[model samples]
Target: MVTDTRLYRKVTAQAWDRLDSRPARRTAWLGYDGSLPVIAGTVICLVVQKLPGGGGNKPVEAS
Candidate 1:
């Protein structure tokens, strides 16, 4: 899970150019930017509410 910032920047620049050429994916990404947070929060709240022992105590697995 290591990143090289310089390579990432270079690839991202190229990807943006390529993505900008397409109307569909670009428009999808436009909505994703706004909706991701609300979606993620809802999922997290649902999981926590469903967790056993009333959600305060986190379970740690033995390594």
Candidate 2:
């Protein structure tokens, strides 16, 4: 979980390089400007939905 760890940095750097080198020109419009936020929000929502009592899969009943 420690981002400062060498392994984490290396893996992330490699992934970034691979993604960065893509020939897709849309990256300029999509990277941080659009897709990143949407992707991040999706990830947050999925994480919250998975947490216990986060009301993900079960329905709550009124008393």
What TM-score would each prediction reach against the true structure? 0.15, 0.15
Q: Candidate 1's error at 55, in angstroms?
A: 3.3
Cα RMSD, model 1: 17.7
Candidate 2 has an lDDT of 0.29
How would you encode candidate 2's per-residue C-alpha lDDT over 1-63 as one tens digit per residue? 112433222111111111222234565565445433222111111112143344434433421
User: Would you list the C-alpha lDDT of every candidate in the order shown?
Assistant: 0.28, 0.29
User: What digit string (tens of lDDT, one per residue) describes model 1 on residues 1-63?
Assistant: 222343222111111121122233445466554333311111111112233333453544421
Show where candidate 2 strays beyond 4 Å. 1-47, 53-56
Counting clashing residue pairs in each candidate, in order, gives 0, 0
Residue 39 local lDDT, model 1 = 18
Q: How large is the C-alpha RMSD of every model relative to the true structure? A: 17.7, 14.9
User: What TM-score does candidate 1 get on C-alpha atoms?
Assistant: 0.15
Indicate which candidate wins on lDDT: 2
- Of candidate 1, the 10-residue stretch with the lowest lDDT total is 38-47
